[model samples]
Target: MSRPRDLYDDYTPSQQMTDAIKAWEDIVEQEKEVRRAAREAIAAELRDARVERDGVEHRVSQEAVARYVPWSEATVLGIAREYKVPGVRQAKKKAADAG
Candidate 1:
């Protein structure tokens, strides 16, 4: 394999090299700032979209829960009765024993 060339082998004058390097560094710094700004803008848009989606999901869940409130309440009451709470009255003896 051919050996890799040394970077400074054909070196230009120090002053010329320093000026060129400074110009390139300035360009790179500006590009980095532009990229950072673009990333922030994208992140803000994503956060707004997520908030909108969450609002829609919350509304849907609330509607569904309202539609089934009576059934849900009945199921909960039945479970409480089976577990012998005083209000349900299905297992008075068990409730008294626990008390």
Candidate 2:
């Protein structure tokens, strides 16, 4: 076994190790930023897609009801969904109510 060196005076890292550590840290931070950005972008895209799909589905139901005379939401469940809407978040209370 080798003798223990004085870490306070004799311990010195190679330049390569220092540089490698710095580069590794920079890369890790960059990757984290990219992942954060991608997650936000995906969330926005999903919200838009949901709104688009909801609009189409609502139109289909509206058309189906139009076939009848004096038709109104009162004749059905009347729970219409909103379209192209943003800045809306579902409450946790709704989950409890649903269950």
* lDDT top scorer: 2
Q: What TM-score would candidate 2 get against the native?
A: 0.45
- Among residues 3 or more apart in sequence or in different chains, the pairs in candidate 1 whose N, CA or C atoms overlap within 3 Å are none
- lDDT (Cα, 0-100) at 12 in candidate 1: 62
Q: How far in Å is the alpha carbon of 92 misplaced in model 2? A: 21
Q: Summing lDDT over every window of 10 consecutive residues in candidate 2, give the lowest-scoring window.
A: 76-85
Q: Global CA lDDT of candidate 1, please?
A: 0.48
Our tally of clashes for model 1 stands at 0
Residue ranges of candidate 2 with Cα displaced over 4 Å? 1-8, 50-99
> Clashes per prediction?
0, 0
lDDT of 2 by residue, 1-99 (tens): 999976687678999999999999999999999866654543344344332342442123333333442435432222223323243344345555775
Q: For model 1, what is the alpha-carbon lDDT of residue 17?
A: 87
